[model samples]
Target chain A: MSSHADVERRLGELLRTHEEQVISRWTQSADAPRDELTELYRAILRAIEEGGRDLADLRGLLAELSRSRARAGYSPAETSKAVFGLKGALYEIVVAHADDEVLRGFIRFARLIDDLGLFTFEAYAEAREKIIMDQAEQLLELSTPVVKLWEGIVAVPLIGTLDSARTQVVMEKLLETLVETGAEHAVIDITGVPAVDTQVAQHLLKTVFAARLMGAECVISGIRPQIAHTIVTLGIEFGDIVTKSSLADALAHAFRRSGVQVSGGPATRVTVRAEQA
Target chain B: MERVPILKLGDLLIVSIQVDLDDQTVLALKEDLAEVVVARGARGVIIDISAVEIVDSFTGRMLATIAEMCRMLDAHAVVVGMRPAVAITLVELGLSLGGVRTALNLEKGVALLDHVRGAVP
Candidate 1:
């Protein structure tokens, strides 16, 4: 263990002595940007000077480098390569001196670089996971949008799979829009929804029930033939909640319920007559 | 004991619950509301809960019970101004408050009661 300490001390001395050469060589071989590589090199020197095995500063710098690279669209292998490049840079300098003790120290230094490279890989993976989580949240926000269809009427056009979290967002948004607009009617259009299982049906019923509890009636629209079939087969009863086959039909129903009369003008009637002829 | 005020507006008794309801307050409100409905011979009762922010299952049950009691006394009850969070929590707790009529605000609640009275007559 003492010899191991001795070798580590020798490596630190050699690193301090050949600082400029080591940094320049590392910059050329590493995949990282030049300015960041220089900053990291300085941190490494500071860690070595502190004279303990704790490379906390160096690890911090490396983690930051890997995270930024991950965000910049670099692959994990490329990110770790930035750390491993130091091994090749130090190997060249150690070979030039060609002493037995220095060579052992070089091996220990190479092992340290390997550990850092693995750490860089771990950091890169963590960054990618965080990016995925953020995108999922954004998708949830984007998928459920409550828009006013008419006076005293609002619509929530639901897209994608109806998970518990996404459904909660949709329900809250729909109910809030109902209160904000004083809309007595809400139409939940599910044309973009891919499938409707029992769970999705349950969520839909809950949303409608919640809206009803707020004194607003909900009209579920965009029920495709397949979904209608599935609903019947699954024995899921929507029980007194109005559902329409299309969004237009749902809006028409909402307008009718809100006592709004929608009649087309003579110009549109002439156009329809021309098309029929 | 804090009491929820019951205001008389023509044939409608408007009970606006403005405070965070505890068990005793809810029980008092129920009893007082029932008494007022009978004494005033009210045609409808509108319960406004827009100021109420939090509700557990007990409060949810009380609202339903109050509405049912008003119905038995031959007075229609409309719960109005229920916030989105409270509604969601009630639904999560599996209390749909099925027989209770709901309106967006007090004005709408009055309009709804007027409509119900018109339709029934």
Candidate 2:
């Protein structure tokens, strides 16, 4: 049987003789950059030189490799293949000179490599989590956009679930836009909200009331049949808050309040109808 | 002892709070606003809090008190130009200032005052 020192010497020899083979096989399998494949090969050889003791260095190298790949949008399968290709190259060299002791030495080496594979997987998971968090933040910003529709009218188009965090963003942005544009009327469109619950209704009411306290009247539009039914079933009361079936209806109401006569198009005939106070 | 200036335009009294008000300042303003409405026989009051960054519950009470006093004098009290952060802070504080009316800015506040003035009489 070969001693630990014997296997270590063999591993060094295996790298010296078959270094290019290891790197090429890994690069072909993982489609990784040539530089990265070279570094990974060196790290694997160093691990073997240390007699497979203290895998922290190996794990650290693999971690960095995996995290960088994750950020670059590489699949986990590709990262796995890159690390495993070193094992394939090592096994091929060992089997080529197959003897009882050297083959047994490879079994121990293979087990060590398996642990390193798990390290790469962990790095991938961590990087993926960061990506998700970044996207959620971006979505929150994009979902609520406050725009000045007319001289004295601002519109906040909301398109997503109405959680407290999102509502806070909506309220702050709406109020800021109201001041920036010096708008008297604000139209809050929630047509893209998937569903409404009492909590969401309360959030809407708070936003409306907050605007009222700032001296800007708010008109909430995009009350679809489903939302309307849900509101009634939930016993949510709007209480003097103006509601409209569509944004166009809300705009017409705002124009009437501001005394901007709309004619030659729609809102002329409907302008005569009484508005609920 | 800095006081927020209260400017009078026709029968409308405009108080634009350009500073972060403290307890003493808020109390003084509450008294001063009531005095303006009663002394000037103001038809409307627009308190603009645009430049104010934070509105704690105490400051919120001052707004409510001033609005109540204006009502007693038969003057409409409209809070205008409250900063978005201030509004969120106030709402989170659970101080809705129930009786006070609000407008987005000075121009809209004046327009609203004209509307209320016409509607009331």
lDDT of each prediction vs. the true structure? 0.89, 0.83
Each candidate's DockQ score against the native complex? 0.91, 0.59
- Give the range where candidate 2 chain A is weakest over 10 consecutive residues by summed lDDT: A263-272
Please give, as one word, the docking class of candidate 2: medium
lDDT tens readout by residue for model 2, A96-207: 8887766766777778777777778888888789889999999999988898778788888889789999998898888877767778799999889999999999999999
Q: Each candidate's iRMS in angstroms?
A: 0.5, 1.4
Tell me the deviation in Å of residue A122 in model 2.
2.7
* Candidate 2 wrong stretches, greater than 4 Å: A1-35, A43-78, A84-116, A147-149, A264-277, B7-12, B35-43
| Best by the lDDT measure | 1
TM-scores of the candidates are 0.89, 0.75
Give the root-mean-square deviation of each candidate in angstroms: 4.1, 6.5
Which candidate has the highest DockQ of all?
Answer: 1
